[model samples]
Target: MHLPSRPDLTKSVFGPQSDFIAVVFSPVLAEWDEGAFCMPLLDLLVARGYQVHVYDSLSLAQESSTLHATSENWDAYLRANYPQIDLAVGQAYGGALVNSLLSGFLKTCPRVLGLSAPTRCSAELQSNLASILTCLDMQGETAALDLLEYYVKPERNDKYQPLPPTKVEESGIGQRLRIGFSQLMKADARSHVNNYAGHMLQIYGAASRLVNTDSIVVSSDNRRQISSGISGCGMRPVIEAPEIALRLISDFLD
Candidate 1:
């Protein structure tokens, strides 16, 4: 087996230095630095005295690793860096990624919040995702953004906007995008969620076409896991319905 190398997670630490730590992962479409996508929730947490560590890394970072290996790297990174983690939050791909990591790592499960998170990648979803992969492969980010637009159009929530297409000529990211999708195609977080012993809140948009919320199962054995649906939103529910999303997270944090 080709053991993938650890990612140089040159992350950004925001908010005041505090005992409480909130580790955040970014959605697939947005880079980790563009925290606005997961804003309000992130901002609210900081205001409530949590030191937020924003991971500003590549989408998948490791091109050859299996989903498990990728998550293992994240787990190891956290273990080496933090004495303890109080909370975990991620959106979409990030959500799923963190879910997989939390499912297995950490002796004691921390409180986790996932938005538009999927524990499994169904055959139908795999098929739909292939087209986006092809678009990224052939036309690059501009054309890929067009397809993402289709993803969020139905929600009629305009608040969440993916970064405008980039004109920079970096070839490495293109390769990573292809590799990332390949891994994402086969990524399954169900096993992770099933094993996770932490208190979790999995939230998805009712109108999300990207993921079938019914498929995101938090194993019945984990009584602490809560799965919720937000109306009038799509994959990007945090930005689309900031008020409701913040309230839900605030309540959970409290």
Candidate 2:
């Protein structure tokens, strides 16, 4: 895979050559690097002829006082850098960021896609995540990984194979995770969804422990409320069913 350079707010430019321009946001604890977990999705989009721009929410969060502020900053960044967006795709915490900014995007982007996205956060979920982070800080990566496995409840499938163990000791990873969780806790995407007048396809893991599948689904009122569209699908986690997830994304993009 050909990896793009890290996003520079002042120096980076979205190329003018591709037919489609996609801005993808990475989940918490993940960066837009060669080893990024979302590389497969990026590679697939590139192969499909998109000029893809990737951003890491953790980095974005570091620069802002609040997640909403971060979303606004990103909105400005997109408007300043890209002529227009063909599609927007985000996963996990990235999905939440996309949701938070969906209203502003509706004017320039026609379609949006969210994978394992959550629309609302409950106190229980917040508490659980806090516990996970505490484990990361006190007991280290091993404990955190164990707790993460418990939360994700990953399953093996033909299309979704287990990934090799990753080292979680990277600098600032823990801080990013904390910031991501805090942002998620404060995120409320209902207003954005209600205001967006464009096509949206929200996909979630039927078995996902992190996000409540019901909260993210587009309600009938939302379907009628949106100007362009609202739709959704549920499947196994991407890591447990990559082919299914990829196919869903391809179909939506096509």
Candidate 3:
């Protein structure tokens, strides 16, 4: 089914000197901006002539907001909000949504880059996510984030370092995190990944047990769809080492 042609994106998303349009589907965190990937990547993209827009669902998901979470509905959301997508970048949870949209509705998009996207949530991921949710229920927001960092960030040989929570906000943040995490664990975009016709580059950490890419086979027939893993970078290569991620992205998009 062809989506009806729509008007240009809102003026707020336009850049005066930009040559291309790009949108980032941000991950599931209230403090997503604090992550190393946020600014560094955006700056790099802007340097490459991309007018970038970041759509962080959690940021707008107040009790009264209408933004949905699951992969099934994001294509409709994008069609309604931002119809002209030149480049689509999804980070983690956002990646799953991007994959889904690309294969089914937004396949005409030129290129997509997935940073540690959870396109295939394994049993291990589900368990870890459930534990994090439980921690949120019992220990509170900061503790839950602490648990999340432990699970998501690991060094070479899959070793984890103790990192403090980036934000210390009211308990209301917990509800948003809970909703996002639930959707993260449930996201599976393998079918979308297989069917996507656009150019794709999906990167993950070498030792990430959270997102199993074993079953995600990007066929050589579609030379555009490629998947790579960064050794010693853990699950979040974008955060652990933004330079490496940036270089890889630049190389791919160029």
Candidate 4:
């Protein structure tokens, strides 16, 4: 499939702003549903005097024709365009993507804010993440299907709660369908845990250790795997994700 030209986000939504923040949303995992996960953050950022750029990972993946884009492509996009993004933020799958982008694309930005970023994304450093991806992708097709049934379908009709009622009004037929399936087939949480866990753990661990202002970590009420002692290494408790997400980005952008 031919990828659409990069949407004219800056001109169409942000007006003409030299310095702005990019608010990339996470791949809506199947069980969690859509609109429920991302819209709250958009509201918070808009209230902050920041021009937020929202990228649906699902839409980009379909157009890009890849379940996921590696950090290299993300970096190249930044270097080639939108390099002026002063700060980048996201959560869960989205968090992983932004971290990957910054790992490759960061130039002068002072901070990157991440919510519920799995330590496994830096697995090479965090030995605990060794099995992360395998656990997720072992049953790839089924997992994908589960995602579709839960989030994508509901998004189509605005049947899911926790989303603002206004959501039904804003999302058109096409976008709802596009968002639903994109979330389903693009990538699995486990696979993401595998590919980037080690790298992410090391990166965030280093940032924490170094007290780097360029990176910060926050998580929804989702508790880490206490048994394994990998605090912050599992699915974010779905309920708290939206609020925690908003706070992290707001502070980072401000």
What are the lDDT figures for the candidates, one per model? 0.71, 0.64, 0.68, 0.39
Off by over 4 Å in 2: 1-16, 30-32, 155-170, 222-236
Whole-model alpha-carbon lDDT for candidate 4: 0.39
- Tell me model 2's lDDT, rounded to 2 decimals: 0.64
TM-scores for every predicted model: 0.84, 0.76, 0.79, 0.46
Q: Identify the leading candidate in terms of lDDT.
A: 1
Tens-digit lDDT track of model 2 for 1-254 = 11123355312124445878887777775234532556667777777888777666655466326778778767777666667888887777888888888767444478788777766665655676787777777766656656755665532342423233454554555666667876777777877776677777776655455665444745455453221111222222455566777777777777
Q: Name the regions of candidate 1 deviating beyond 4 angstroms.
A: 1-8, 30-32, 57-60, 155-173
The pairs that clash in candidate 2 are: none
Tens-digit lDDT track for model 1 on 1-95? 22244355456777988989888877655233557667677779999999998774353356676667777767766666677888888776677
Winning model by TM-score: 1
Q: Can you rank all candidates by lDDT, best first?
A: 1, 3, 2, 4
The whole-model C-alpha lDDT of candidate 3 against the native structure comes to 0.68
Q: What does candidate 4's lDDT look like per residue over 156-205, in tens digits?
A: 22342322212122223333333433332232333323233221221122
lDDT of 3 at 124: 81
**Superposed model 4: Cα runs more than 4 Å off:** 1-19, 28-36, 58-69, 122-254
